[model samples]
Target: MNTLFGSNLKYDLKASLVVFLVALPLCLGIAIASGAPPMSGLIAGIVGGIVVGALSGSNVSVSGPAAGLTVIVLDSINSMGTFPLFLATLVIAGLIQLALGIAKAGVIGYYFPHAVIKGMLTAIGLILILKQIPHALGYDVDLMGDQAFLQTDNHNTFSEIWYAIQYYSIGAIPIVLVAMGILILFERPKIKNHKILGVVPGALWAVLSGIIINLAYGVWKPEWQLGGDHLVNIPVLDNLGQIGNLLTFPDFSMIGESTFWIVAATIAIIGSLETLLSIDAADKLDPHKRTTPPSKELVAQGIGNSISGLIGGLPVTAVIVRSSANVASGAKTKMSAVLHGVLLMILVLSIPTILNLIPLSCLAAVLFLVGYKLAKPSIFISIYKNGWDQFIPFIVTVVAILFTDLLVGIGIGMVFGLFFVIKTNFVRSVTLTEMNGNYLLKLQKDVSFLNKALLMKNLSRIPSGSKVIINAQKAQFIDHDIQEVLNDFIASCSDKNISITVEGFKYKIHENI
Candidate 1:
């Protein structure tokens, strides 16, 4: 563990700090966006980063409140009313995830087609692009930050885009433009040579630029409209004296509500899926190709969520963006994740002012980059190159996801992928020894309706007048459909003056044969 993929404490500390900056606002934004109290996000992030990070076997995978679970969490809180009961559900769901891991259900991921996974990534990319536009353009709808595509008011993703353009503000555009610039310049390898700026992240740069732009708007164009609900405004508490007031505990009375269990299940299922998917991605990204222990991951996640829930935090899971950022930042072990969580706790609880200084728009810029990477063109090209078997499932998944949601899209893709597999296995063959420049096919084993297509194709491919032999040493469960194909072949041989022979096939039970 100390060699190869492992890193020195120096690199891990640097990477953890970088990841901490990257994860902070995301935690707040997703929590705010999910309709939960803004602090719930921070709590989940802290727990995921510190508690789960230490317990998780994953080296690069980072756990926290993910954007993917935002919709579910929002819906759940609204429906359940009593948030504490939801905590109980988190415990139950964690148990389920833990059981799945122990039962060796990690292999369940392999059954998912590559096409479906790509489609999922693409669809999410599209959704992320669609969701962020309102914030990027500076629209100030009351719930503009919520996770549901159509807000609780029934405004779909596209509707929000339309609304944002109609209400687009000039002040917002400049920040995004700077963000765009930061994104571009940071990626160029040549930028590394600039001693001061190299080690610092593009995200920090983009965010700082946004805050500066907002400040300028406030000074010059007082009506630039940068303030209001558009900015992240978590109430700043001064040290340990006020920390208790900032945090809220669950209402224990809701524990008996059946609705609470349902909400918990939703959070657990969605959180587990997203975490597992991220874990899979992290494994692929690991230079050494070390797979994350999935069951262990569930146990860690469960422990984190249970703790987060009890302590007035939102649900938690392994978020892909942070995991990707960790890997990109040269994180080599779970220590980076653990340290990042510790840093988040210290910053939010101890240094609240610095936390508030970071602008929301800057965080949105980071998300834009993450979304783009998730749905890159290169990913599609790679899937297409894998051919139709891979491509069809992938396309189906993408289409399903685009039309429906993540779980539904994956379900549709899996159903079709299974069909394709069964279709491929429908043909059986019999080999033959050379006799007078002709060959024989030995057909045996449960010959059923599945073999019909293959039988017809092979019969047609062979030349007429070619001596053919049928050897069925193990003909059992031979269906009428196969018998019809064999009968046709015999009839065709006679018409073409082709000599044919049959052997080994015996009718043990059927009087009709």
Candidate 2:
């Protein structure tokens, strides 16, 4: 028990700070993208960290506003016509997530194939890099955390890059290049191994550099300054009395609206899937390889989202960027995740002025490295070496995600994965062995309807005068169609002058025939 709280305290504390640095810009950026109050993302981050972290079984996963759900959330808010009504949907979505947790629906995470999971991570990384490019180059027209291919400005991802290239800021360029350089250097073995340098995370250094450089620009070189649009925009709270003004509760009077429930259900399902996938990814990244209990994670997210909605925050999910940063920062337990939430709350309430000085380009540079780490060329090489069966689905998932949304891409990948599964099952359904003057047919585990054709084809190859033994002792399940095929073959056996013996089939000759 002591170890749970105290183990790796130094690492956890440092890592929590790193994650908080990474999450702050994202929280604000996602809110801007979702068309909600910027403070809403902060509230969600606080709730996700403290509330969800307390209940989650994940050791290193960090939950907050996800870029993946920005499109759904934005559309829901616009369609609902009121922010309070959107809050109502969040509350209902939380309840649905709670119910899903109680029903053990989180087992769905385990069903996603490894190839698809890898693809999802790689795709997310690619999207993060592409989306951050504009912000990193001082073009702030696109929100920092927007992950969709299509932007709010009617421009796509590639088009945004062109815009950034055409209108790059000289001041922002140095910050991004320096931050990226520092982050990349910190990842190197020698730099990381340095005792003094190793203690200071590259993200913290990048953020500090951004703040100092911007402050220096204010004193001199005013014409070459980065604008307010390129800085973190944490809302300044004057007093404790004004806090109540910021929190907007859900309107229960809108319970009769059918659109409310539809939006809630969509948020619940999509949020749960994203959370499950993020946790699975986090667990894979955990150095200790500790497995997270998925059901508990859903309940945690439910509570957090409910609180977030009550306080007028956006929907919350386990975000992989923050989670990956948490793990990479040497977090050993959930304490780091919890501490990050606490820090976010403390900073927003007490020191938001200092946090606001952070340049958006610096944060963009940090995320660029995180994205590159997840989608490195080595990852592609490793996946390719696994052969076409795995590589095809992996590559398809990556391409699909790059073109479409996350959920749709995963759906396409799963369908392709299922096709391969069925194909493999069809080929291996039946085994034929030739014995002296006889043929033995053995059915393996769980025969499906797809195997019926293969079974019939194998049965047709038996010699006219040969004796046949059909074995089903090992098969746990036989499809009704397969049983019917076997029954029809048994009835026709006498005419072919073949003596047949059947084992372990419950079907009676008269009833089946």
Q: TM-scores across all candidates? A: 0.81, 0.92
Clashes of each: 4, 0
Per-residue alpha-carbon lDDT of candidate 2 for residues 343-428, written as tens digits (9 for 90 to 100): 99988888888888888899988888878878999999999998887888898999898888788888898887777777777787
Best candidate, TM-score-wise? 2
Candidate 2, backbone clash total: 0
Whole-model lDDT per candidate: 0.72, 0.87
Name the candidate that leads on lDDT: 2
Candidate 1 yields a Cα-based lDDT of: 0.72
Please give the lDDT score at residue 151 for candidate 2.
Answer: 80
Q: On a 0 to 100 scale, what is the lDDT of residue 128 in model 2? A: 80
Model 1 weakest 10-residue run by lDDT: 504-513
Model 1, 94-133: lDDT tens per residue?
A: 6667666677666655555555656666666665566678
Give the poorly placed runs of model 1, Cα more than 4 Å off. Answer: 1-22, 140-148, 193-196, 248-266, 285-288, 328-330, 424-449, 456-513
